[model samples]
Target: MEAPRLTTKTFHLQHGTSVYELHLKRLEADRVQLRGTKISNPEGSKALDEVEAHVQQRGNEIVLKTANGPHRAIAVRTARGVWVSLGERTAFFEFARKDVDAVSTQPVKTEIHAPMTGKIVDVRVKPNQKVGLGDILVIMEAMKMEFKLEAPMEALIESVGCEKGQLVDLGQLLVQLKTLDNKKA
Candidate 1:
């Protein structure tokens, strides 16, 4: 049997409007260049800037470097939707796995995983610990940089799968949490 395909559909900020489309492939492990076009803007205006970015994933933090400058971002999968933070600017965008054309080929879960292979310098929370939204959970050191893994929402820690001094592989689960009342159910 042939392998299935996974696709993510999202709206990117184009000027001032949301342009919706399906994101087909990831050009590299961290860099993704999608195949789609938007018509919600002016009749012939370009929907997006031609961007070339080098993305580095360190735990929950994402660093994107481009011609403009470097940007720090955080990604979290919440019950309501995906939350992405780029530097001091943050935005929330909702997406359904069913709306993602690639769901058949991808696995979905709530655990926060390491974005890249790294050494765990610190494990901040204990199992079953109560944490508020934006609490720092782990500290990962990679490529001479230190990254703090922050909580996406308020929650009680279900388990911490990794320990300090442990080497975690990319996409390895580091922590799990039970969503608290402050978060959308």
Candidate 2:
């Protein structure tokens, strides 16, 4: 069977202080092509040259086949962005909505959204529960992979918008929290 064609989408990915514009399209069910250009280059380092690579997903990992050879990485999609780990390096890349020309910075720190369409395997917090930064608030499963949504800051849960075993769409607000320091929710 032939794989379906996927539309190309542009995303702004940040690593350290540098940002890149990446256009991605699926060439096959397991093969993707990405073209990237460095959009912001700070001092003390060189800009990334234009790059094109064929990518494939292997379970929770991804392999990028470039002219320089193959590289492996793992990517986790979170409520605020995608966290990509390569070798000894990991970077959080805040994503622009697919096909959109704008960038999404960190959402209000008190809200936790569903990172992808998935079934909620666990809801780990309740209203009034205090959670610290990095606490796991929700556990979801998508495409047979589990994602642990962590607290972005110390906060008290204001509400739970989902339950265990419930399916949620990408970007759905799953939890609302009020910061512990008297900031806004």
Candidate 3:
């Protein structure tokens, strides 16, 4: 019998002023590898680096590991959008329908939520805090691993629904942002 076939997708990222394109291939047994290319010619030559990784589904928490390190990601299904975690260093990603591939198994939203029931290890933002699109909002500790929650959009925080050291449920509201009043003064 032939091995099961999986899908592949592409993504683009901008760090500072440089842009990169990433090609991701999903294999059987939950294996994924990514290769990145710099869009701008001045950045560098073309090269691809492969990482050995596997994904484990444990209820709400999806743990992904590569040879370099391991990442704990959270997913929350809301009426608005899907929230996903990139890794510990980066904030969560809030993705809308257009920003994600139709066939990808990952969530679409950039907003990071608790992957499992855990205590808030640290609250990085305060109520009414103005944050950028990828700012870190909170850090949660579960099963001795740390997960960072990030903003889905660039806006002023309307309210912080959770506090430091507070125990949060699986789908609890940790932070809320008010839409920017773009009207001129």
On lDDT, the candidate that comes out on top is 2
Give candidate 3 regions above 4 Å deviation: 1-113, 181-185
Candidates sorted by lDDT, descending order? 2, 1, 3
Predict model 1's lDDT versus the native. 0.70
Candidate 2 per-residue C-alpha lDDT over 40-120 given as tens digits, one digit per residue, 9 for 90 to 100: 322322344555677778776989888898899998887777888998998888854443223223335577899899999
Give Cα distance to truth, residue 64, candidate 1, Å. 27
Note the Cα lDDT for every prediction shown: 0.70, 0.78, 0.66
User: By how many angstroms RMSD does model 2 differ from the true structure?
Assistant: 10.1
The global Cα lDDT (0 to 1) of model 3 is 0.66
- What local lDDT does model 1 show for residue 135? 93
Model 2's alpha-carbon lDDT is 0.78
Task: Encode model 1's per-residue lDDT on 1-185: one tens digit a residue.
Answer: 44434444444322223333545454555665555544342343234444656788888788988788888899886665667888677777655333323432332234789978999999999997998878999999999899999888878898999999999999999999877653445
Candidate 1 residues lying further than 4 Å off, grouped into runs, are 1-109, 182-185
Candidate No. with top TM-score:
2
Please give the ranking of all candidate structures by TM-score, highest first, separated by commas. Answer: 2, 1, 3
TM-score of 1: 0.44
Q: Candidate 1 has which clashing residue pairs, if any? A: 6-102, 7-102
